[model samples]
Target: MGADSGFDMVPRLSQGNQDRREWERFLEGVKQYYADDEQVEVGPRVIQFKAGEWPSLPMEGHKFLRFSSKITGATAAKTGVENYIREVQELAKAVFGGRIRPWNELFDVWGFYRWDFVHATMKLHNLVGTPLESPAVWLVLPSRKDIATPEPIPLTSVNNQGNTDLYEVMAIPGRGKGLVAKVDIPKGTQIICEKPLFTLRSSAPPSMHHLVAEKLKLLPNDKQREFLSLHNNFPGQYAFAGIMRTNALPCGPGSSVGGIYSTICLINHSCIPNAHNNWNEEAQHETIHATRNILAGEEILISYANEPSQARQRKLRESFGFQCSCELCSQPLQAIQASDKRRADIEQLDETIGNPVAMMSSPQKSLAACHDLIHVLDQEYGGTVIALLARLYYDAFQICVAHGDQARASVFAERSYMSRVECEGEDSPVTQKVKGLMRDPTKHPSFSAYSTRWRSTRTARPRNVDANSFDKWLWKLSG
Candidate 1:
């Protein structure tokens, strides 16, 4: 049942103005709400709200709550207050067992804190590994039941024309731990689909330290050991926090949270990486795919930073405490200068094509610039920039379709769809929409808005023309 306030109340630290009594009242409110449930047993240090069968929250049916006294702010300095807090904690432990002890210990070390309790309709689970050998807490919120219980994808299976077991963990010369292709991996092949060991909020509060430590204590012995053994570049008193910062990848669509995967973290960074890692929300997994064909023994690399610019990438990687000596960063001065020039040109063209006035005034020029941008990106990053290429093709598709150039629009849409499927999986919404547009360009949101100046049918295709001639015709490029 919903709270009497019609909203969940989570305790928070009041500003300097709020007195201790206000905090006490807030604590009492939380206790009363949980106590109201006959199935829930409130103890001095912990509270256990049993999982109910009926739907109480938004879209979720079953719900469970386990709160520990470690969440309280009582201290030894406040004699009576400390006794009250201990009583609450002991009561919780009596009903739920000593699981709250570790949580309480962490709280003692990291000060007490509270978070706002919001209704979560989805089934949320804290995924853990063997007691001693795990990464961190992985909070799984699956929109569908199937996503929560994903089918086991074989590591060696040749499904979707990819061998997931193509890579092996190895120590690289400069990089500490890196993935090396055990077999020749072709472009667009799914390399790995790793479920996170644990996940944390993207913008967690300082009190997250205690929360994480508590979660770590809940892991099986082996899992906790594995988590503690993880590499932490940012060494400090709170080692768990450092490990999280070093290896967690963005999890959800908004990237408001992060997840840690054991095997995926082994792959190191490169400005011009041969592979890319994507968070597949639909499948509830993190997928790694080869951006280009990788030869056996070649180290697998992925860009650590989203910025395509080399200078920015170098600066960004520095925060991770490592100098990237990848091909792009370690290139000769002459080669670097040339690459930088091309990158600058690509940025300028991207700006021009994005400008509404430039597009309206000279659509043809903007289209040409898009082509130029693609050429430079291809020359610089090869198939690794397939995601960028897809966007460029979609832009061209929109422009051509708007001007009633159905033939070119169809071709661009096809190109866009293929590239998107190669980068993001076919199940992706963007890829699916582009696939539909390839079949019928007229179905596009911007069908023929501007003019029918270069009108052509969706069936238009070059016949008997050489590959070079076909490309020229497709882009309407001059000799």
Candidate 2:
């Protein structure tokens, strides 16, 4: 082959390009191969390029290759274009020494974009690629500069390390034993990162007794004692399964698996909790963050239930074998009625904010829904509730991103990152993802979903305004 030939121009080593110079030299060599069909475009936060056939892609058929860092679309290997897809995949492997999948495998197989976590959902639903509400409900949200000067949020780790000085575990009046703060704990402080003594795979209740027994046998003598010491709601029946059922916490939100943490499990439940317990995937441990200031000698409580007061009471009784008499549950008749109304509104808004189809078809409306959810949350809790707000802000980020709005997306990501840190600390994988989004919202796989009508660059953010102006810009509210 001639020196100008594409095959000889680039080194095809398995280790891939060793440096930028090598990759650039290789790109120059192969320019002739894709000269006819290729296009390259560089943006403020991302680069996009279309290239020739993939010679060795795993999928059948040939396909055109669009390599991008910010956007993803449903791409399947077509009869003639599979070669391009193969070459792109192999070339990426050759350059980065890893697989580079810009599209979801399931989406590629299904020939549509109905699957995937629906971008930013907390309720976890497979809302189809069709709109749940009228498409015209999508109000055009205005983006104006009305934001306060941005402040930095520092990430901290949960380094409690089983230290007892932060809080002491002791008997409570009627709620058995719980943790009490020995010193004033500030809001957003992650006071504990406790590793689970053992984790249980999703299984049937009949087998849990055997499973728990086997796991208990494997623990150290003291850990085994600690496991046995945990409160068991089931008295006459089986001991191991009852404790496992009553004390085990889900490894993470929406996770079917459960883990038993000796200390975290000991902290009793409250409907109005001062601390938030979250499982950090990156840290492989559970963390408890103070959602609001707690005075010394006060109880450090985390919500074991996340349903409405009535619904949560039912859940708590059925699952954990307890009747909740927390502040919200024991409120005066008029106040209890009001709290339930606000909480029910929150659930509805929460589901609406997570509707992917609604978000894509009417992003402005979804953005407005996010605002409404936060408003209700502020009323119900009176201040920032890190756990709930983190998911909502992330949903807002994805809503902006689906329509190609980067300036607002970045702000939402920043807020989401702060919430993640405050709820799960900096070591969480979710926090890191949000941090990356703050710099380049396009890094999200869902960017430019189906429209770029609201497209704007990161630098397109409005300046010389207070935080309110930024808010108006973000929500597309007019001054």
Q: Which stretches of candidate 1 lie over 4 Å from their true place?
A: 1-164, 204-207, 214-223, 237-239, 252-254, 306-310
Residue 357 miss distance in model 2 (angstroms): 2.6
Estimated TM-score for each candidate: 0.61, 0.67
Query: On residues 344-437, what C-alpha lDDT tens digit does candidate 2 reach at each position?
Result: 9987997787655577678788889999988888888866466678877888888888789898889888998898888777887777877988
Positional deviation of residue 416's Cα in model 2 after best superposition, in angstroms: 0.3
RMSD of each: 17.0, 15.2
List, in order, the clash count of every candidate structure.
33, 25
In model 1, how large is the Cα lDDT of residue 378? Answer: 81
Estimate every model's Cα lDDT from 0 to 1: 0.57, 0.61
